[model samples]
Target: MSTAASTEACSTSRRMSIGMLYVDLGIVTRPQLFEALVECARTRCTLPAALASLGYL
Candidate 1:
Protein backbone atom coordinates (compact mmCIF):
# COMPACT_ATOMS: atom_id res chain seq x y z
CA MET A 1 0.00 0.00 0.00
CA SER A 2 1.02 3.56 -0.47
CA THR A 3 2.06 5.81 2.40
CA ALA A 4 -1.16 7.80 2.17
CA ALA A 5 -3.29 4.68 2.21
CA SER A 6 -1.45 3.33 5.24
CA THR A 7 -1.86 6.62 7.09
CA GLU A 8 -5.57 6.76 6.28
CA ALA A 9 -6.03 3.19 7.49
CA CYS A 10 -4.23 3.95 10.75
CA SER A 11 -6.33 7.04 11.30
CA THR A 12 -9.55 5.18 10.64
CA SER A 13 -8.60 2.45 13.10
CA ARG A 14 -7.73 5.00 15.74
CA ARG A 15 -11.17 6.57 15.39
CA MET A 16 -12.77 3.14 15.73
CA SER A 17 -10.60 2.41 18.77
CA ILE A 18 -11.79 5.55 20.45
CA GLY A 19 -15.40 4.63 19.86
CA MET A 20 -14.82 1.13 21.24
CA LEU A 21 -13.14 2.60 24.28
CA TYR A 22 -16.25 4.63 24.98
CA VAL A 23 -18.40 1.51 24.61
CA ASP A 24 -16.15 -0.57 26.88
CA LEU A 25 -16.19 2.18 29.49
CA GLY A 26 -20.01 2.09 29.57
CA ILE A 27 -20.31 5.59 28.22
CA VAL A 28 -22.43 4.35 25.32
CA THR A 29 -24.08 1.16 24.13
CA ARG A 30 -22.88 -0.64 21.02
CA PRO A 31 -26.04 0.31 19.17
CA GLN A 32 -25.66 3.93 20.16
CA LEU A 33 -22.05 3.93 19.03
CA PHE A 34 -22.97 2.35 15.73
CA GLU A 35 -25.69 4.92 15.25
CA ALA A 36 -23.23 7.69 15.91
CA LEU A 37 -20.81 6.18 13.42
CA VAL A 38 -23.50 6.10 10.78
CA GLU A 39 -24.50 9.66 11.47
CA CYS A 40 -20.90 10.73 11.40
CA ALA A 41 -20.49 9.24 7.95
CA ARG A 42 -23.63 10.83 6.63
CA THR A 43 -22.86 14.22 8.08
CA ARG A 44 -19.12 14.08 7.53
CA CYS A 45 -18.79 14.99 11.17
CA THR A 46 -16.31 13.85 13.74
CA LEU A 47 -17.12 10.90 15.98
CA PRO A 48 -17.14 13.07 19.06
CA ALA A 49 -19.58 15.44 17.43
CA ALA A 50 -21.79 12.58 16.32
CA LEU A 51 -21.80 11.13 19.84
CA ALA A 52 -22.72 14.51 21.23
CA SER A 53 -25.55 14.86 18.75
CA LEU A 54 -26.81 11.45 19.80
CA GLY A 55 -26.69 12.62 23.44
CA TYR A 56 -24.08 10.01 24.30
CA LEU A 57 -21.71 12.62 25.65
Candidate 2:
Protein backbone atom coordinates (compact mmCIF):
# COMPACT_ATOMS: atom_id res chain seq x y z
CA MET A 1 0.00 0.00 0.00
CA SER A 2 1.02 3.58 -0.47
CA THR A 3 2.08 5.68 2.47
CA ALA A 4 -1.12 7.74 2.15
CA ALA A 5 -3.27 4.60 2.22
CA SER A 6 -1.46 3.29 5.28
CA THR A 7 -1.93 6.57 7.10
CA GLU A 8 -5.59 6.69 6.20
CA ALA A 9 -6.09 3.17 7.46
CA CYS A 10 -4.41 3.98 10.75
CA SER A 11 -6.54 7.08 11.18
CA THR A 12 -9.72 5.14 10.49
CA SER A 13 -8.70 2.45 12.96
CA ARG A 14 -8.06 5.03 15.64
CA ARG A 15 -11.42 6.69 15.06
CA MET A 16 -13.21 3.37 15.35
CA SER A 17 -11.41 2.61 18.56
CA ILE A 18 -12.50 5.91 20.07
CA GLY A 19 -16.10 5.23 19.08
CA MET A 20 -15.93 1.77 20.59
CA LEU A 21 -14.45 3.23 23.75
CA TYR A 22 -17.54 5.33 24.22
CA VAL A 23 -19.75 2.27 23.78
CA ASP A 24 -17.61 0.09 26.04
CA LEU A 25 -17.75 2.74 28.73
CA GLY A 26 -21.57 2.88 28.55
CA ILE A 27 -21.37 6.52 27.51
CA VAL A 28 -23.35 5.74 24.38
CA THR A 29 -25.10 2.85 22.66
CA ARG A 30 -24.16 1.45 19.27
CA PRO A 31 -27.05 3.29 17.66
CA GLN A 32 -26.09 6.45 19.47
CA LEU A 33 -22.53 6.01 18.29
CA PHE A 34 -23.82 5.78 14.74
CA GLU A 35 -25.79 8.95 15.29
CA ALA A 36 -22.76 10.73 16.67
CA LEU A 37 -20.74 9.56 13.70
CA VAL A 38 -23.32 10.99 11.35
CA GLU A 39 -23.34 14.22 13.25
CA CYS A 40 -19.57 14.33 13.24
CA ALA A 41 -19.50 13.92 9.48
CA ARG A 42 -22.24 16.45 8.97
CA THR A 43 -20.56 19.08 11.07
CA ARG A 44 -16.97 18.08 10.30
CA CYS A 45 -16.27 17.96 14.01
CA THR A 46 -14.57 15.58 16.39
CA LEU A 47 -16.48 12.75 18.06
CA PRO A 48 -16.40 14.31 21.50
CA ALA A 49 -17.56 17.61 20.08
CA ALA A 50 -20.32 15.87 18.18
CA LEU A 51 -21.40 14.07 21.33
CA ALA A 52 -21.48 17.35 23.19
CA SER A 53 -23.52 19.00 20.46
CA LEU A 54 -25.96 16.12 20.55
CA GLY A 55 -26.28 16.51 24.34
CA TYR A 56 -24.65 13.14 25.00
CA LEU A 57 -21.60 14.57 26.71
Candidate 3:
Protein backbone atom coordinates (compact mmCIF):
# COMPACT_ATOMS: atom_id res chain seq x y z
CA MET A 1 0.00 0.00 0.00
CA SER A 2 1.03 3.61 -0.37
CA THR A 3 2.53 5.26 2.71
CA ALA A 4 -0.62 7.32 3.37
CA ALA A 5 -2.84 4.30 2.92
CA SER A 6 -0.70 2.22 5.27
CA THR A 7 -0.80 4.94 7.91
CA GLU A 8 -4.54 5.25 7.63
CA ALA A 9 -4.97 1.51 7.99
CA CYS A 10 -2.80 1.46 11.07
CA SER A 11 -4.78 4.30 12.60
CA THR A 12 -8.07 2.54 11.92
CA SER A 13 -6.76 -0.71 13.41
CA ARG A 14 -5.60 1.09 16.52
CA ARG A 15 -8.94 2.80 16.94
CA MET A 16 -10.81 -0.49 16.62
CA SER A 17 -8.53 -2.07 19.20
CA ILE A 18 -9.19 0.69 21.68
CA GLY A 19 -12.93 0.36 21.26
CA MET A 20 -12.75 -3.39 21.68
CA LEU A 21 -10.60 -3.00 24.73
CA TYR A 22 -13.27 -0.87 26.33
CA VAL A 23 -15.84 -3.55 25.64
CA ASP A 24 -13.56 -6.32 26.86
CA LEU A 25 -12.95 -4.47 30.06
CA GLY A 26 -16.69 -3.89 30.56
CA ILE A 27 -16.10 -0.16 30.31
CA VAL A 28 -18.69 0.02 27.57
CA THR A 29 -21.12 -2.24 25.78
CA ARG A 30 -20.74 -3.14 22.11
CA PRO A 31 -23.93 -1.23 21.31
CA GLN A 32 -22.61 1.77 23.22
CA LEU A 33 -19.38 1.57 21.30
CA PHE A 34 -21.37 1.48 18.09
CA GLU A 35 -23.29 4.55 19.14
CA ALA A 36 -20.08 6.32 20.11
CA LEU A 37 -18.61 5.49 16.73
CA VAL A 38 -21.59 7.03 15.01
CA GLU A 39 -21.34 10.09 17.20
CA CYS A 40 -17.62 10.27 16.56
CA ALA A 41 -18.22 10.35 12.82
CA ARG A 42 -21.12 12.77 12.97
CA THR A 43 -19.42 15.19 15.35
CA ARG A 44 -15.92 14.71 14.01
CA CYS A 45 -14.79 13.92 17.55
CA THR A 46 -12.60 11.22 19.05
CA LEU A 47 -14.08 8.06 20.56
CA PRO A 48 -13.37 9.15 24.10
CA ALA A 49 -15.02 12.48 23.48
CA ALA A 50 -18.03 10.77 21.97
CA LEU A 51 -18.24 8.38 24.91
CA ALA A 52 -18.06 11.27 27.34
CA SER A 53 -20.80 13.06 25.48
CA LEU A 54 -22.91 9.94 25.72
CA GLY A 55 -22.34 9.85 29.51
CA TYR A 56 -20.36 6.64 29.32
CA LEU A 57 -17.01 8.15 30.17
The C-alpha lDDT values of all candidates are 0.86, 0.83, 0.87
Error of 1 at 6 (Å): 6.3
| Per-residue lDDT over 1-57 for candidate 1, one digit per residue giving the tens place of the 0 to 100 score | 999889767766776899999999999999998998888768867889999998889
**Model 2 CA deviation exceeding 4 Å by range:** 1-12
Residue-level lDDT tens digits of model 3 in 1-57: 899889766765776789999999999999999998888768867889899999999
Q: For model 3, what is the C-alpha lDDT against the true structure?
A: 0.87
Error of 1 at 19 (Å): 0.4
Candidate 1's displacement at residue 47, Å, is 0.8
Q: CA shift at 9, candidate 2, in angstroms?
A: 5.7
Prediction 3 TM-score vs. true: 0.76
- Sort by lDDT, best first: 3, 1, 2
TM-score of each: 0.76, 0.74, 0.76
**Which runs of model 1 end up more than 4 angstroms from their true locations?**
1-10
Task: Give lDDT tens digits, candidate 2, residues 1-57.
Answer: 999889766765776789999999999998888898888767767888888898888
Mark the 10 consecutive residues where model 2 has the least summed lDDT. 7-16
Compare candidates 2 and 3 on lDDT and give the better one: 3
Off by over 4 Å in 3: 1-10
